[model samples]
Target: MKKETQIGYRVSAICGAVALAFAGLHAMPAQAHGKNDVKHVLLISFDGLHEQDVARCIGSNACPNLALLAKSGVTYTNAHTPHLSDSFPGLAALLTGGSPKSAGLFYDVSYDRTLYAPLDSTCTGAQGWNVVFDETTGIDAKGGGPLINLDGGGAFNPDAIPYAKVGGVCTPVYPHNYIKTNTVFEVVKEHIRGSRTAWADKHAWGYDWVNGPSGKGVDDLARTEINSIDPKTGTYYLDTYTHTEVFDNIHVQALINEIDGLDSTGKTSAAVPTVFGTNFQTLSVAQKSPVADNGGYLDADFTPGPQVAAAITYLDGALGRVVSELKQRNLYSSTLIIVTAKHGQSPTDHTKLVKNGDTLTKLLEASNYLDSSGNFGQNNTTTGNLNDGSGLSGTGFVQTDDVGLIWLRDQSQKDAVVKTLKANLGCTAPGICADGPQAYILHGERLEHWFGDPANGRTPDIIVQPNPGVIYTSSKSKDEEHGGNAPDDSHLGLVVSFPGLHHGGRTDDRYVYTTQVAPTILSALDLDPDLLHSVQVEGTRTLPGLGIEHEHSQDRD
Candidate 1:
């Protein structure tokens, strides 16, 4: 048998469903992490954290814990997430060692022609559904209302799950099985005997992808609801930075509980996960909050306003708490803490934000690509409802934020649609603003080359990348948006901090992709990066300078 297959079979037998006891290594020693000495990989993602944000926060002393983390680790100044920086693919890259091409997660809300609609369970439908596994997939989404009950209404609702014919029977495709690649958690869990895996994030149902293919990768996934209604106020948990901080704190405490060798709720004692982390949304919420001076920089120089500054301060304090807990538990030296972002918000310069109403969709509708009432691609984060599919036009799917992603009812019309888009580059048509910024249309071979082919049933038939700072919505609530091809949208801050990583700290400016983090995590734990499907297929490598790679990104430990 092939070595990879053998390893998989062997580990699958060992890493069973039942929890196992971990050794008494807690009393081993408290020392700095050395090469090949990493036992725990703490991957922390500060969502919407930009490379410039880190540099400026450190220089300004606004983020002391972040500065210290950078001091003890190597910072990749030019690390970036996948193109068209949506959180689904962005986080997928960090944990799966793949891009949209290999990971097969185009966006959190995208179109798939091969899958039946959520309500279609008889193995029959038009064979296309707008895949929205966001907060709307939560149990509270039953009435098309706000996510009220916390804990994401007990995760994704059965009715909200998209079904398809697998083998010969129609079955629901969970987020864990939807993605094309295996994640670090899956590889680590299966490879390391008795080692636990855990994670915490903003979504309850939306983050199931972290579990990887087998759906058992994350032993403890804290389901903090980012969009649950604040019962006392009848507002979403994401309505204000203050509420967002509260939502983020629930997960932070969950991570602390995990470090304490307990479950995410601290109610049950469990083995500390071998691989674990959480993504913070305070910065993201701050950057996107529409309140005046609540987000974005004061200028192109990246000066933080009061709210952004406060958000960074909260993030630093949160990091400091984690560090202190690690030291208290003596896991500091044995843990490798990686700090980065799933994606970055755009238009760091608030002045550049251009908001308009549904121009791209209007253009497509006017061009006959979509019926007059047809709309597709419905992941609008600014909308009051979460995991919202109510706006789906039942004709086509076109999701827009800073970018326009279209999946046509008929894929053969892609060429003609592209022709119409090209003809209206200036968008002088009445459907679109004559004075609006021209967009770059990616269709046909070009779109397929970067992402996968549209024939895959998941890739958008066409993508529209407007000029930077142009958000597709005219909502007055947020200062920035993501999911675009802009520099600010993709660029992210990356810091790999171990106890004694580089002695005095170092910075690597090489263009590294977030996909490398997955392989690097495995390498740190003395596991094989090739165990990951994407790492092997995409040639993803470990971060440079770690002893995990003798030659950096090549040559195993």
Candidate 2:
């Protein structure tokens, strides 16, 4: 048998032992309800959504279903994501009740200490630090020829991908196995009887990673491959007009099926999911489209272009379908609906858009911080191919979007590298750089203050924050991106609606983090929020202002 297969068996045995260790833990009573009330909790995420967009859509009557949800629950106007918000960290915060510090998740494509690149044979090769498990790495080359299976259920090949070494054992780090902490799904299943969880997401890879360590958190995982290449056309479907919008409907339909007690495969006799949800990418896609007014927002004013307006209408309609389904099944009053975003898009104002003249990679390459032969350009040919690790491990590896993160191999060169970066692109003042767009450089201990320390294995050594409208890429295909400290990226929409809340339709101005969602869900179900390992480490609290108390509160040792 192959080494990865043997390791998989060993890991499976370890997970089984861990599950058995906790199997005897008794289920807790429902805190906010009696034995017969509030049995289901549905959590939904709308990617790239901003709080202002939600207000604008509801105020202008562009989204009647969202307005109705707000009328029946509480809307948090000042809610925000972590300072350095990305989809991976954002979702981890929601499901783990912790920030990147506690959850050990920064982005889908990030650095790791003990993981080896699949293409590298030395195991300690320079490319080993570069572990990517996204769509490109997880594509299934069978049946339809690179077509993503929405219901594949961890069907991707593990041996072909990079593996992470834990306790001297190397195991294929599939999406469902990457997370370092337990998710709300595991908490629900371990603490509640007959509790099954389901989720649908954009990629089959990163989304499945939410199953947490034991690899059994989510019962049904629907992988809607948004960027799959069409076998017949030999082109990426997401590049086509309104293709993502059409594909999003499939996930919404899956939610309906799950609510109706059908499996993601459309088979009956499946148990209804206790906690089920999916994400909407229409708004994010619309916002980034180069076409003006293509069903996305125009500027910070949130004036919906035709496409953005239509996307909002479509998402609102999807929510309406979920509500109608629950009501029809007499499950509406028993469900908790959460409307929020994984991350907000940047450059909300098109007029302020600035193409970075001197990219960070060029500056780093010139400084000898990057491999001399490596193609550190916008294409990222070397890192993308997982080849030529040469300078990546010893020198440093830089990852960028709207923001930039640098992981250095030698701690002694930190001061020199930071000094060089400042000389090239550092801001003169808070947000004003000498050349190019305004930028802020954070290094040394400041990195730990904002995004934890590099010793944690996931935190970056240095962070680059540019002006709201500044982007590193020159690609004309997108107008805006996320992953920065700007208000446009950090601020997001958040709402919590339940049947027995004290106040409905009232807006709260409290400053709450998205990480609070995990603990709150546990509390609502009468399960201890501290059951989530990260929650205990971070002391994350349940979202306040819901006017409901958890039945029991205990800290996990």
Candidate 3:
């Protein structure tokens, strides 16, 4: 039997088990809300927002709208993303109610065992791995062409794409069909009648992916590719402006259209979605800008630079517009607003910037582990010749940000690789080693503890933990990067608000993972969180102190 066919049978068996489990379960009665009660959830994420940035802007005119929301809601001061915080796994945690361990997502470009390399036809290995839908895939080579046809709503050629367990089918998978678990959107749609969900994200591919394998979770998905540099004009002018704030306004308009019973494309007669929201990118852009006084921080204080301050103010105004639109449509008091971030930017202090540093890549190259054909940092390598499997086959591939995830072609070379990395990248300085600015190596059991075991095929063989500001890019474009266990990267801003909550306007200092956002949304809608596969699989609980509780009657097991 073919691997694809075997995977299909295995999936059918799992579905049978799930159906048998559901046969013994009964749907919980919906909690009746009074007139003027919360009936909708508007979940908004400000990508790369730090908790301190919110603190610094609160009570100031720069972020009056966010301050108002915080004043009317419960703010979680110590909320965090997962330890291996990349945008893919970060948002996966938010939507799937589990970390990468349960959700089976590591990053946008990650490794897999039971998959073939779509770009490399000559690949032959027991474990095939390659980049998913990143830049190197040539999906967007025409600079937002049919391969990236979020605007035209066209699907990619499945034959030329890698396969994954999406929508219960192990066929070729698109970016929107990669997640292995059900999302809150899928749960709400399945259980709730007359419920509609809409979302806008940095890429059209992002929110669609969050809708999970079924592809029927969200009713409206708006695509605004933030990173697309136009092929003709060589600018990002189609979806962005000189500032990300101007770019985010496009999403703001889409949200308003959704509120006004219209789709993101200005289609009239669209139903107002029950759950709808979008993410903002201004703060993230500000944090990475090289221009002086444009970044998110100036000194020890959280005071943003001039451009950043303006971006915050503009974002506040955008929030005010959303609130005003809700009130105009009589939807304000009855709607739950969630203000949080997908991930946080690292090195809030500009003085911590490290540049022209490709230390880890050089070390791997010296050890003959890195493939000589492809470029290391940005994903603009030659097509067809790219390594179709993990570094263990011919040469290895290394993905580096503040942290380094190394995939080796030969597992037998693990010891030599670790020894070489420790000798070169490991830090021994006293204060730096104690966490100020240091490097740590994780392999064997330690790596498995934080990230899942590499034997599972998704986890990397080795992880290079550099100090807080040690980015492994030689490019001078951006000052800071993420995807590390550093405090600046993991710590995030989280606020939840709804009418009639007891702890409104209060601050909660308890540590919470962003994964709690998924189950919490299910609980708010009076639905069982266990409907989401990962919530049940991982035993993920709702956010603490949500005030509203549900009967744990569903037989998720």
Candidate 4:
């Protein structure tokens, strides 16, 4: 009845399907590794992390644990994620060795024609926004109603969204539905021998794939508590809590449990999962956690810089705990550890940006440029459609902190939209919008590079590039934000600490991108690069200081 209940039922069905599928696959005994064989890989993602933060921690001696890791490991200075580095897209590239081109993950919640409707089309007509489908609804689109329909059925509590009042519905598209390709974990499990895998994370983009022990490569893991669909009859349900809490409490606890099992079971010889990861709740801590950001009603802020620092310390402690456990069990030195982030955040001051003198906002309002709902770019007003090329009026527009995604008012209006934007918002006037390096009019090859399917859903006419100091926020604009292509959001940290590393203590400024993370991991594991489906994107070469000798003859390859 309730949407939450339906979500639970759907999650259970997926797990059931996974179990059935796994049962059909042949099972094999755990393989033992020869002496000196690397036994573990630990990958951790720090949400909203900048390269400077790592450097600051090292310089300030604030992160002693990470410092020790840096001293022993290789710290890559030029690692980066692709432009417009959002979490889902960034992680998609990290795990799949591809961009939106192959991964089909363009944004935090992108459109999927086969599995789910695009966000704008998924919702019921009156809801004003598109409906995001749930598993219970299935592909047929049955049993979906205003979110009230699900909450009314006693599925999930309606306290968060006021679905009863606004007729809102939240049908999350699961990871399997979102990702179109296999990840490095899946490849490793399928091809490698005598290896086990595990993962933990709060975000659906990364760890949800590892929910159960089947398709997800993790032999043991924790997913964002399963989405509950059935209040009383559902088979699976994550306790109602925020993702940050789940990551800090349940996900981290699950990792600890796995470590404890490995230690107590004396199962070092038992094929242990070679790859394991956990993404700490740094964003929530930095912007909202310990405080609810007015129950998700306020804009994001970097005001809690100290809280972010505290979270970093806490996560480092967790890292120490895991590493200590491994060492106590005599498995530490053999493991390869990596620390990085999905992307970084930008500093924005909504208070200053919203004043009448906020030239950019005034420009949009003067041009009769209405967002999705026929309203001019109003202050603190979100959830409007953009200038979509659809016949609908006011189809596309900008909202929040200056980030605009244009939905053409008609298919023919695309050119007009581009022309109007380049002329009106082209940074010429004091009141016009400012375009950053990340902001560009994608067409032809560039558009195709980011979206495999441009026909159904890729992006709108233009992606409003947030300036370096701006972020996209809901209420009160924001104090800080991401979703831009600034160096802060794109530049990331890459730390590789393992035996056989060149003690060269070298830091090369060579260009590297997130597309290289997967290949790097696979290469570290002594696996073939081709297996991960990586094509050596421009500037994506191997790490230089790994002590793994590369022949100059084959270097051209």
Q: Would you list the C-alpha lDDT of every candidate in the order shown?
A: 0.77, 0.70, 0.66, 0.48
RMSD values, in order shown: 8.1, 9.9, 9.4, 13.9
* TM-score of each predicted structure versus truth: 0.88, 0.85, 0.83, 0.66
- Candidate 3 lands at a TM-score of 0.83
**Residues 1-557, candidate 1, lDDT per residue (tens digit)?**
22221111122223321112221321111113333557789999899899999999888888889888888777789998867798898999999989988888988888787887655678565677778877766777765665778887785776567777888998889898798889999888887878899998877888898999899999998887788877778888787787888888887898899999899999999998899999889888888876475566788777877777888899989999998999999998888899999999988887777777668888788778887654343432224343433334235688888888888877878879877776665533333322344457778787888888888788888888877887877688887999977888988999888765433366777898899998878877767778899988888877764422221222222
Candidate 2 lDDT, tens digit per residue, 1-557? 11110000012334445544654562111122342355788898998888998998889888888898887777889888867677888888899988877777777767765566554443555433655555544446322245444433346644235556656566666666667789999888777777889998877765777898888999888766776754545666466336676778778889888888898767765888888888888888877877553634565586777767777788889899988998998899888889998898887787867665437766666667766555432124333433222214333467778888777656567789788876665433222232444457777777787667786666777787876777777677887788777788888999887765433777877798898888878766656777899888887877755544323423211
| lDDT of model 3, residue 474 | 62
Candidate 1 Cα deviation (angstroms), residue 409: 1.5
Q: Is candidate 3 or candidate 4 better by lDDT?
A: 3
Ten-residue stretch with the least lDDT total in model 3: 1-10
Order of all candidates by lDDT, from best down to worst?
1, 2, 3, 4
- Decide which is better by TM-score, 1 or 4: 1
Rank list by TM-score? 1, 2, 3, 4
* Candidate whose TM-score is highest: 1
Q: Please name the candidate that would achieve the greatest lDDT relative to the true structure.
A: 1
- Evaluate candidate 2 by giving its C-alpha RMSD to the native, one decimal: 9.9
Those runs of model 3 whose alpha carbons end farther than 4 Å from true positions after fitting are 1-36, 119-127, 135-153, 157-160, 164-170, 229-234, 237-241, 291-293, 372-395, 426-438, 552-557
Q: Which stretches of candidate 4 lie over 4 Å from their true place?
A: 1-36, 112-174, 204-216, 219-221, 225-249, 262-271, 287-304, 348-411, 426-432, 435-445, 449-453, 534-540, 547-557
Q: Tens digit of lDDT per residue, candidate 3, span 285-395?
A: 777776453555676566777756776777778889998898899887778888888888877777776654666766676667765544442233333323222223223
Model 2: worst 10 consecutive residues (lDDT sum): 1-10
